[model samples]
Target chain A: MHGETAPPPTGPFADPALYTEITQFYAWHMALMDEGEPDAWADAYTEDAVFEEPGRTNVLRGREAIRASITKRTAELAAAGTVMRHWMSNLAVTPQPDGTLRATYYSLAMRAPRGERPDIFAHVVCRDALVREGERWLIRHRHVGIDALEK
Target chain B: MHGETAPPPTGPFADPALYTEITQFYAWHMALMDEGEPDAWADAYTEDAVFEEPGRTNVLRGREAIRASITKRTAELAAAGTVMRHWMSNLAVTPQPDGTLRATYYSLAMRAPRGERPDIFAHVVCRDALVREGERWLIRHRHVGIDALEK
Candidate 1:
């Protein structure tokens, strides 16, 4: 119901202000994780944000729940002590008519244990996200699918 | 050397036609793969393209080599009979004074058997691309890293 603002003639895709703000959010969002802090991930989304994957029936709702999920994953991955580096690129920001923004990005994540060929795990995607809450954007909903999924 | 088309009063991060061309490139580039053509991948890049992965010296140089590399990868993965889908989203298009667009995208690629919890691959950043050949945007250089590499 927060669609009061008349939709901009052009979506955020062509707006530098909105585009840069959202892009910076992405960089900061990852930096928090890069420093091994999952709590920040929870705070990044809105209070009523929704996180969904392909198979998981339990949609992570609310900021607290979102934090819990990320924390659990972080704990498990931290045990291995493998340095995780995320390289995000090929991003497209589109503005919806409702004055919100939707974006798609390509990401390549690599993991290594101090040193190691078979160490590359890449996920490329067309992620669709809704941005709201004024200039402050939070991912309202996300649908994640892998590049190589069995049909 | 390609900075001849610099505008008189260009604002920061403002480029409509440039982004349009770039976005079109991304859309069609992904579609080419959806068509299941490996050669198309190579042709999508410049004659001198560089594909680099973290902690690896396996840089494939030139169009022919790049094509061969992609062909080998496709052939190897095809043996598993798994379907591959590349989804690119959250694109940040930055136009340089040199007439080339710098784009950053976040990506998620999933791989698995039909109706299963596919292995989730997260690519953090895929960057360093150049668009040349007039209205044709091909990846000149690509650098990719992973998020959950060890997990």
Candidate 2:
């Protein structure tokens, strides 16, 4: 029972243009990360954003901390000569009453070592709360859960 | 890359009321299943609905088949006196160009014996294509994926 706290009926993303823009925002976020642009990736989040992985109990608050975490992971992969690609699909966007957007998407991470075939390294569902400051939509909170850990 | 085939900007669910209605539909669908109503659960899908679990390669087509599958599973659980609770969160709904709605959500299934503590049994992401035939939205195609299976 979700208990009556449904999202708002319509907000900024109700408009087609804004919806497309939000989608592109996610696309660009992924592109920037894949291109090793950590600074740009961190810029995608709000100054006080919160990133959490519930399964691992890993939480990073604020844009600077999030940036450092991603940078460190990307550097580790690069140093090991590993190629990583993140594929996201089944995205759904909803408008919140407080003028924020709630975006949920499925992500699959494929990793390969130099010349080896790519293999699925992780699969997760990401729930993101996004806000628009000025003309840009930034992530306010992101919660990720890894799937099928229990037998 | 999603490759140019993006979801429609607006459709029946573009209206706030309709969006809320569709969300309620899912709520009721889950409630019906939890209440051991197999016939009602089958009614949630269209006559020619397709239910697929891609990770397990399990596919059930048509309403009757889907119903039978649910009925069978429920019966087995009942026979063992086990209780199953499905918790869904981070739901996102998108309207399709052909008048269908694409609903994506994360599901965590918890199970336990009649008098024991519940434990998570499965975690999955569900992508469903919903259609409105006569003022009611029903699922036309559902694709489910379990996380982190491939390595």
Worst 10 residues of 2 chain B by lDDT: B111-120
lDDT of 2 by residue, A45-140 (tens): 999999998756579999999999999988988888888777665455778878898887656566777778766566566899999899788999
Q: Which candidate number has the best TM-score?
A: 2
Model 1: residues >4 Å from true position, as ranges?
A: A1-13, A122-126, A148-151, B1-151
Q: lDDT tens string, model 1, A1-151? A: 0122422212223455555566688888877776679997677788888877665337777788888888877887689776666656556677777866677665545666665632435454547576677656787776665443223
| lDDT agreement of model 2 with the native | 0.73
The lDDT values for all models are: 0.64, 0.73
Give a tens-digit lDDT track for model 2, residues B19-124: 5555446645664675577777787688899999975757998988998898998898888876655657777788777878888888766554543434557888
Query: Residue A131's C-alpha lDDT in candidate 2?
Result: 93
